[model samples]
Target: MNLLLIAALIITSIAVLAYIGSMVLQSWLYSVPADKMPLRSFVTALLAGGFLTLWCWIDTKNPGRYDTLFSFSSYDTEDFDVVDAVKKVGEEEKTIRYTRRSVGTKMVYMNDQNQPFRKADAEGAIFALIVTEKDKPVRFITKLDKNGNFPPGEIQYREEGGKRYIDDTMIGRVNRPGTLKVIYVLLLNFGHFLIWTLSLWLVMNYALGHAISIACCLWLVITLLIMPVLFTKTRKQEKVITPQVSFPSVNDPNLSEPEPKDEEKKGTRQFQDSNGNGIAILWIGSAISNS
Candidate 1:
């Protein structure tokens, strides 16, 4: 199989396994309801798959952009004088020395005259290295120690038998440069992964809601399950309590109770006509009784 394909397969397999393990752990630790397990697994797989797909697409479109974004240059010990090395920004040059600046934070470049350059000029050189002169491998002269020994942060090349090889540690430094560079690469990839995962989840959630199937519902349940499981406590499942409703029979005493009538006025009786219109009639007691 092609190396890139093999790498992709390995990465995807690891992602799937990691996702499954996380879900299993969460379910076991938090006692995630059985009904929600399938959905959670599906969502995890979807997110992992989507991120991997996006990464693969980007990698396919531009082969080495991802690697170059985080890569640094390596140098041999004899090409330039370490003590006299200077960082050139515009027309001004500042001497390079060990200082408090974080490692890999400084962008270093060599001009056609074999000089160190930085800032805008260095950036232009980097662009050319990544684009125009990509066919050529870029390397640099390493800085030496006080005892003329190969020092940290410098990758040295050596010749053995009729072949040239780099020391193991030196190869690592060449590939990774510094702690900060590794961290930067990690954070960049993580940011991309998060963005793609969330976007895919949202679109899938919306589409699944409309479709409405056992799988879709399970996915929704798992989606709901994540927030509460990761960030908050799992809510106690409440038992469905059916309210007991009782109706009074016609023979019950409560039902037989007559409603109280309004007290009659001393000299007026309220009457309703045949048309159901109510009117107040002025009358004496005997006349009211007769009416």
Candidate 2:
């Protein structure tokens, strides 16, 4: 099997989808037309995310865009010292040095390169990462400060693999990155629509009438009125998008294509309108005499 080709296709598909999704999200956030967003988004993701995707493919096992946005904190705080007993090659335990910074309540540890060692908490205990241990993952001791407590914050307790085991030791307690990303996408894209529609409905119904049915009726009308502007696509964009895994098939006779020239010749299609239209209505038993 051609794994490299497969990986490329997968990554390209994801990058395009991610770009479109993020574009729609931006539209909702910025009150821009969603259709007009894809062209620009498609260009940027293919050009920018393409290189990052390649780098990740070369350096890592999985395929994904290494977006710096979700990867880092706003800024690092002043560094503090942390001590760890890492196992040596033979049978000795050596002190591994690290610098820690507190991003909010979470303590981040960085190596000599000043880069974060643990991208995520669960990744803490990989054998490639570990004490008097041979061919085993390194073990870590609970850290304490001058006050003799575990730094008076969350432990982020590590286990066999680089995973965070919290008070609810079960894996169910931890939310996966993919799940979190989905949630964030939904909330950002549709959150404004929901907030405004509900708020307007609530206020109008309360002031005018006092019933669930009345509020629901108001909500329906408000939805239709507001949808023509914010949180909806207003017009189509005509810009050509940059490359992102598109292979046009020239030999396909069954493919359906839009005939813009024909549509344009008709202008705004009017009903009444034409014999074809009246016949279609008559066929469907909805035709009535003008008189």
- The lDDT of each candidate is 0.38, 0.39
TM-score of 1: 0.25
Error of model 2, residue 187, in angstroms: 8.2
> Following a full C-alpha superposition, what root-mean-square deviation does model 1 have from the true structure?
26.3
Off by over 4 Å in 1: 1-23, 68-188, 192-291
Q: After superposition, how far is residue 273 of candidate 2 from its true place, in Å?
A: 99
Question: Over the stretch 26-143, how does candidate 2's per-residue lDDT look in tens digits?
Answer: 4664455334344544443444334323333432432121212223222212211442324233344344444556668766665576665431232222122222234443443344
Pairs clashing within candidate 2: 87-131, 122-162, 122-163, 122-164, 123-162, 123-163, 124-162, 125-161, 125-162, 130-138
Model 2 — which ten-residue stretch has the worst lDDT? 167-176
Name the best candidate (by TM-score): 1
